[model samples]
Target: MSSEKIIQKIGQLYHQKLLMLVKDVSLVLVVVVAIVESVVRLLVVVVVVVVVVVVVVVVVVVVVVVVYSSSSKVVVVVVVVVVVVVVVVVVVVVVVI
Candidate 1:
């Protein structure tokens, strides 16, 4: 009977240790899941910022091209007008003199 009690006590101790191991494993799993979630969120934010910056750069490039082309056209028109006015003034002065 004394040996029987010793065996039962040993069995109980083994069961307690198993429960503790399971609890530790579960805690470690929860921490790992949290870390993974944080990493995913950070990656998502980075992707969004990159996309926004790319779009802004494209828009600015397009606007600059359009504005520069239109400004070039205006410069050409002004040059032609100035040449015509100068020719007219020279002819008028020759006739008057």
Candidate 2:
């Protein structure tokens, strides 16, 4: 083969190699982008779940506090009624004697 023919073949081979390299680089970039997007989506879901749990816990706490306060008020009213009844009975017995 002549030198001119050999040079032309070498140039063609280099061009093909360059094209293959560009395709490989593009594939790598696409895979990296997909992985990053998936991680970000997962993080967002976790944050949303945490926020919902916190809100539910706060609502439950408020309800419990209100119930406890109402029960305490009922106990106080019962105690006052019992004391008044005892005092009235003692006064009636003294008046009869």
Candidate 3:
């Protein structure tokens, strides 16, 4: 056989041997990676949920924490109402994402 063809045959045979040796290991690696990816995705979802809940709770606490002046009662009411509504909308959007 020509040198080039002989080299090509050797490469093919070497590849076959390498594949036979690593097939099982390659499968295991794929499975492990998939599981790790799934776990990471779950953790991300959980973190997002926790953050949204904390934001809502903090906003609610702010309404209780601030002592408003009587003159600015209407403004305070409007601000507080606006903040709460914004928070709710943000939570919804974040959760959907």
Candidate 4:
């Protein structure tokens, strides 16, 4: 074969290989991005859930203390009710979303 033709063939092969490598790398990057996105979404959900639980508990405690600070029995009943309501709300929220 002529040297010019052989050189052209080698150039074509190199171009094809380069294209294949780019496609492979792009596929890997897409998968990695999808996984990272999923993890970030989950972390965001967890943080939101934690914040919500903390806020609810704090509010309930404050309300209970302010309203029934002198009655131990009433305080206990209110606390138990608050706990059950919090649990139910959390479960419903989680399930709905």
Candidate 5:
């Protein structure tokens, strides 16, 4: 073959190789993008679950605190009533005797 034809053949082969490289690179990029998207979605789901758990725990704590405080108030009221009755009884007994 002539030198010009040999050079043209080399040029054609180089072009084909470049196209193949571009195709492979684009495929790799697509795969990487898909993997990243999946990881982001998974992270979103995990965050949602964690938030729900935290909210449930907070609500339970608040309920326990309210019940404990109310019961303690009831106990205080009972003690006060008993002390007043004892005082009134002692006063009457001392006056009569």
Candidate 6:
């Protein structure tokens, strides 16, 4: 029948349109997923770099404190020794004269 043929053709065209819409949706989904993955990767790299910089700064601060403390102790010892030597010499000279 002519009506039957027209109905069949219309059904085929509808099916084809549905397939095309599905393909377009799939392509859009893939692009969205790729964009999300890239953003996550970038955030991870930024976090890692920030952590490493913080660790390095802490290490440097600790090293500076240790070095300054040791040097200050050495300076105190040297000053004490010099004062003792000068006092002893002055006392000896006063006694001899």
In lDDT terms, which candidate is top? 4
Question: For model 6, what is the C-alpha lDDT against the true structure?
Answer: 0.71
Estimate the overall C-alpha local distance difference test score of candidate 1: 0.71
Clashes of each: 0, 0, 0, 0, 0, 0
Instruction: Tell me the tens digit of each residue's lDDT in model 4 across 1-97.
Output: 9999999999999999999999999999999999999997898688668758876776777696858578788777777877777787677667645
Clashes by residue pair, model 3: none
* Structural similarity to truth (TM-score) of each candidate: 0.62, 0.58, 0.51, 0.68, 0.69, 0.63
Error of 1 at 21 (Å): 0.8
Q: What digit string (tens of lDDT, one per residue) describes model 6 on residues 1-97?
A: 6999999999999999999999999999999999999997787667656655655565565556656776877656655655565566556544533
lDDT of 3 by residue, 14-70 (tens): 999999879978999999999999998888788777766877776666565454435
Off by over 4 Å in 5: 70-97
The C-alpha RMSD of each candidate to the native structure, in angstroms, is: 23.1, 23.5, 5.2, 6.2, 22.6, 23.0
What lDDT, from 0 to 1, does candidate 5 have? 0.71
In model 4, the runs with Cα more than 4 Å from the true position are: 69-97
Q: Between prediction 2 and prediction 6, which has the larger TM-score?
A: 6
Better of 1 and 2 by TM-score: 1
In order, the Cα lDDT scores of the candidates are 0.71, 0.70, 0.76, 0.81, 0.71, 0.71
TM-score of 6: 0.63
Q: Which stretches of candidate 1 lie over 4 Å from their true place?
A: 69-97
lDDT (C-alpha) at residue 49 in model 6: 64
| lDDT-superior candidate, 4 or 5 | 4
- Candidate 1 lDDT over 12-77, as tens digits, reads 999999999999999999999999999977876676566556555655655566567768776566
